[model samples]
Target: MTQQTKGKASALFPLLIFILLFIGTGVLTKDFSNMPLNVAVIIAAAVAIFMNRKVKLAKKIEIFTKGAGHENIMLMCIIFVLAGAFSEVAKGMGAVDATVNLGLSLLPANLLMVGLFLIGCFISITMGTSMGTVVALTPIGIGIADQTDIPMALAMATVIGGAMFGDNLSMISDTTIASARTQNTSMSDKFKTNFFIVLPGALITALILWFITSGSHINQLEDYSYNLVKVIPYLAVLIVAILGVNVVIVLIGGIILAGAIGIIDGSYTGTTLLQAASQGVLNMEDIAIVALFIGGIIGIIQYNGGIDYLLHVVSNKIKSKKGAEFGIAGLVSVADISTANNTISIIMTGPLAKDIASKYNVDPRKSASILDIFAACWQGIVPYGGQMLAVAGLASISPISIMPYSFYPVLLGICGITAILFGFPRRKVKQ
Candidate 1:
């Protein structure tokens, strides 16, 4: 490859190696955290050096370093560290139990399950990221289950369900933007189509969750003592996030509040607070490693034109308007599973999706909705995605175990595929 052009295929080899070593090992072990992710990243980065054909040996290492050190990547790493600190510190100070009891106290015991599920949905929709919503709520959900005798899997599903709800429809969501920009459409136009299509499915999911936990016991044993004022940290984070504050600031604020509350209330010593922050940052090591390795490899792939090559190879055989649209969905869904990131899937396939949209005379809005909906649907149920990771972390359960109990994700996927086939939200072609 010339200095002006690096091929995506070659660049992507490190990513492929990482996937095989990391994800494949996790599957083989049935325990995702069995192998430390940083080790996998180190292996992948070593491979990336040899994979570079165009750039000089020195430049290849530079490319890898640059990708790993990107501003966005750095920011995410910071967020991951802060999130870890905030979560650990909060839980250590009795914040998790406090939040849980407050929720239980206000909820009707008979409808407690439904209430938790709805709250999950509400928080996700407001926040616009399934992962973010999950981090903030999953522990609380688990604590509630422990108190109320709600099944762990069933309770975990509530938060997962709600997180995906926002992921699919949030106005400022990365997936939504990726879909819209890829299809050359406005966000407002895509939302109209998506909202109508998912309405039936969302309601059905709510009903199913209600049925699953309708008889949950909310009986009183010893009422746990919780400092109501200690809950302020979580509330502050939520309010800041909802008001469009940047996520980094939100995390830092939460961390500070949690630390201060712990100290002021005698729940923790100053050194303990610092240790909690440090532990939290350490806990995110796996996630941060995954992101950096994936990004570096993906960058190489793009430089090598691997994605473009695939798109070219596939587009020739795709015939007819219907086939073209479905092909686009299939392409993006496979990418999502491979990358385990819905946002990245959309980013990779946005141009291809647009080409199909234009060639088929299909409405751009419909195409964008299809891309976002399908990716979101698959991401929701995938055991490797962030949703599962957070839920599994909270309940100490394998993601696979929760799959069967996650009626909402399964039904939403089915509902989405059916919507596509039946054209329920049929596009009205204008003359």
Candidate 2:
């Protein structure tokens, strides 16, 4: 028989300390970038290890290693590395510029904000990373704001809203991967459940942007050049992923296709292709390390009964399935708000959310959807979040300036909550 861990609120102190150290440094320094997330997690892991005197040191080390080396966690880290490599290889081959130009060239000048939003959505979905999308589109948005009557904050907010939309839905996104894996569901299954819930919000946000920018027009529009061939890899990745192919295979294929095209088009030499791939893998190092640390810390916490304590408290308050869903949403939202990174938030809250879902007989797909949606919602709007901060810095504006105009995240939060209450897109419970 398996051992049953007792609930212990004191076990959560280490997690609390990590949060305080992370958020505290950011708050005091007035710059979140000053304190690296991995550093914060390392301290938290140490605290978790040293606590609980009753457990032997040897057993604690075993628990930590087991969690760090868990199949799901290891798989997640590998995906992050592969995703980074594919993204870098694609960008090095001029895929990003080509995709951006192609989208902008086709958009109407009069509908600039709407165009930006739509293009941001498309690029972010294909890129599978919002940070990259925001970086690529913010300059374009700034130029539009300067040339036209659009407010800089509004233009930047449009980019942010669209990026968040894709970040929440993309098949290759770290947030989506973490949520789906932690909930024990497939990415395609989670995407389907997530898409329907957020579609209404996206449509509404697009319409709002259209109405706001309908009267605006650029004084002089530049004709952007693009290569259609460079765009094929992104499309293939998206399509293949949706068709339920293995994620690792899809990413590997994308890298090969992108690298081949880059080499043929003279965008990359044989040696440069290897360099780009290595750079991409290096770019993902921080997140991969953070994931390992978080896994170890969470493993320690679980061993010390922190997760059971949380489950006990949450279970006492949750009466129905809908309440249980809300509990899951709230848990992830708080984590995102605290961490300011949607992917990390999902990872931190996922194990607990899975426990809640199983106890309430909630669908794993739906639980995964809730985790991604809520995490993205808060991450998009929070001024401290990387998306908002990056866009704000690029546009030379305050992060707070972008929040009011970030309509998608607000609408998404509403839609997510409504989906929980009314159970829209209802699926028959599996027997």
What root-mean-square deviation over C-alphas does model 2 reach?
6.7
Candidate 2 local lDDT, 69-103, one digit each (tens)? 87756766676677678877887887766765665
Question: How close is every model to the real structure, measured as TM-score?
Answer: 0.83, 0.66
Query: In model 2, where do residues sit more than 4 Å from their true spots?
Result: 1-6, 108-200, 208-221, 318-410, 418-431
Model 1 CA lDDT for position 404: 68
What value does the lDDT take at residue 136 in candidate 1?
A: 74
Query: What lDDT does each candidate get?
Result: 0.73, 0.79
True-structure RMSD, every candidate: 4.1, 6.7
Report how far off residue 117 is in candidate 2 (Å).
6.3
